[model samples]
Target: MSHAGLFISFEGIDGSGKSTQARLLADHLRGLGHDVVLTREPGGSPGAEEIRALVLQGDPDRWSARTEILLFTAARRDHLERTIQPALEAGKIVICDRFADSTRMYQGLSRGDLRAMVDDLHRLMIGMEPDLTVLIDMDPTKGLSRALARQTVEERFEDFGEELQQAMRTGFLALADEFAERFVTIDGGRGIDEVAADVQQVVSTRLPS
Candidate 1:
């Protein structure tokens, strides 16, 4: 947890409803008058957005795991420098949709050699990370169904089939097990109000009180 201001992040497999839940939580906090900066990874910065497109383009079958990992890292570097750092420095509560943890799950867990990449990033660029990370845990199949129902394949990762996405979800859980200090998994298979309430409670209890 952060010593002073709140710096929280949300993580999940694609279609885990992180963005929706993040918005709900941020809205709840703002209702209480806290300054909140709600944003997403692979974006939230000009440079990162470009990298995001590159990372998410084409068919999932055509993309390599190493390539996915590197693209994620590149986008993260831009986001940290351009969006996250500035907001945290201003003492604002930042609720990022995803952070380095996504890379850990997607690249390291799914692909290979996650430790080396994660350590390098921690050592090189990222200094202060999220005070708390909310992992929206759900069946990847269910999530993929929901996501696909809404969109028409905008990117590569988004195009991954349900089985592969389920594997990705397991990877995310492995990250939570290893880094329990910062990761809090929430059941996102519940009703929207229930999920939002859980997120709100987690933030209120964890944030400065």
Candidate 2:
């Protein structure tokens, strides 16, 4: 589908500073006079947020990988229908903290090898990819430490430990390679202002004046 606005997504392991960077980009864009929609995954729209509570609260093994993917896809569908698409149609840049890429990394790499299932569901249910994907790349050790410091009810993903996080980092990098055109890997180890400058520079180049 064609859109007048841009769709940008941030992808990374549990705590790779992608979310913070996403917000920074949105703010920068808004400051430049572009209408910006700052949102997140598993729970962008109302219905999706409801699903988010369900999927996030339960035990880590409560849902099987197959079932989990189905739930995630369902939430994503709701998010797209209620939040993302409308904003894009209205010419508002949508900056999402996470998107289908998170599902691929978390579900396929961390949980189970159901990547094929994840891809099929996304293609069938949510057939759209972000116009630009900013992957805030970081060392798993550093990212994991940052993640663990944050206390939240949404500990399901973080509970996966550093090993899984390492795997996820690898997976994200591989995805960056696969979707190189839309994907930009920004080193997330630097200070926030420094990283934000690079992110803003990259996004400014892609976005229209």
Candidate 3:
């Protein structure tokens, strides 16, 4: 799992603006002449993208908690193998919209008390962690509202309603504590430019010169 490049992942509840910030960071880095690979979970590589449609577009109860953990892990493994690892090995900066941490929150804690199972599978299958994780902390209510407004087919998670979003916010904050070394919390309620500036500053400190 060791590589010559930096691996960064973004984690937050639905509507936390993590995806937009991820893209903004990629654009900033690339403009600075850094080689960057911008990707997302559940559908980064072709194989993982296929699995994404299965897990993200169905009913809220489409897959049980255990089943979801398996599917997300499968997609993550493919993403790592096909997209993430290659870029990292080539010494490129790999910025992922979401990663195993998303699975930990969405599948591990949201549905049931299966976090241990999620961690076990991750250690066994995806034995790596991001060098830095930017957590775009936002109010669950506001985040959920922003998320629903998108009106995309990937609304299965959002369909679970605000209660789930509240729990996810709490869970993600707790996770930031659990893995504080790599997690940096940022207030995401600000304007896009403000948030992107903070993201760039945090990441610039860690990027290789």
Candidate 4:
């Protein structure tokens, strides 16, 4: 919708190096003559940070499915209003580690309606979508191994067993396929630098001159 700035999102299962790659890409973008802002979902703005803690504290039983989605959507609304929108309006490229796609993958696992809810929330809150979304792909077994290896703190999802984690991986890949045009699934099994290079290539090729 006539944005001079670009919105790029990185998505994947935990430990797929989305955060690291997001940072790397942001840095690379800034180096290549772009004003860049790096942020994450459920924790970008102050209000969202509080929601993030409650969401990750493993209190699923305390939250109904609708409640969980609503909390995430509320956090997203605040983040877009307070952080992302201003950055974009200022003509800064916004590279987000996770966005509405995470809600679809995490909350919509069993409840299909949750995906619709998240889509509606995204449209209402952000009023836009990423120009390109990169989904870092890795086997869940390997991803969890990496996740556990890097874990200083465990979130609710990190505690899930192989089965559920694998399902989540499947969900991400399915989404990549579903939104093929906006989605690019990178091979996250490679070394970090190698993956970073691949991501840089994608960014350099797409970024506006």
lDDT for every model? 0.80, 0.90, 0.95, 0.83
Cα lDDT of model 1 by residue, 123-200, tens digit: 576656688899999888889888877765464766757776888888888878988998889999999899998888
Poorly placed runs, candidate 2 (over 4 Å)? none
Worst 10 residues of 3 by lDDT: 101-110
Q: Give the better candidate number (3 or 4) by lDDT.
A: 3
Model 2, 1-209: lDDT tens digits are: 67888999999987889989988888888888899999999899999999899888758777787888988999999999999999999988999989999999888656878898899998899999999999999999999888889888888777778898999999999999999999999999999999999999898888866
- TM-score ranking of the models: 3, 2, 4, 1
**Could you tell me the lDDT of residue 142 within candidate 3?**
98
C-alpha RMSD by candidate, in order = 2.1, 1.0, 0.6, 1.8
Error of 2 at 148 (Å): 1.4
Per-residue alpha-carbon lDDT of model 3 for 40-90, expressed as tens digits? 998899999999999999889999999999999999999999999999999
User: How close is every model to the real structure, measured as TM-score?
Assistant: 0.91, 0.97, 0.99, 0.92
Candidate 1 ranges beyond 4 A from true positions: 1-4, 61-63, 113-115
Cα error, residue 128 of model 1, in Å, equals: 3.4
lDDT of 2: 0.90
RMSD of 1: 2.1
Worst 10 residues of 2 by lDDT: 57-66
- Give me the candidate number with maximum TM-score: 3
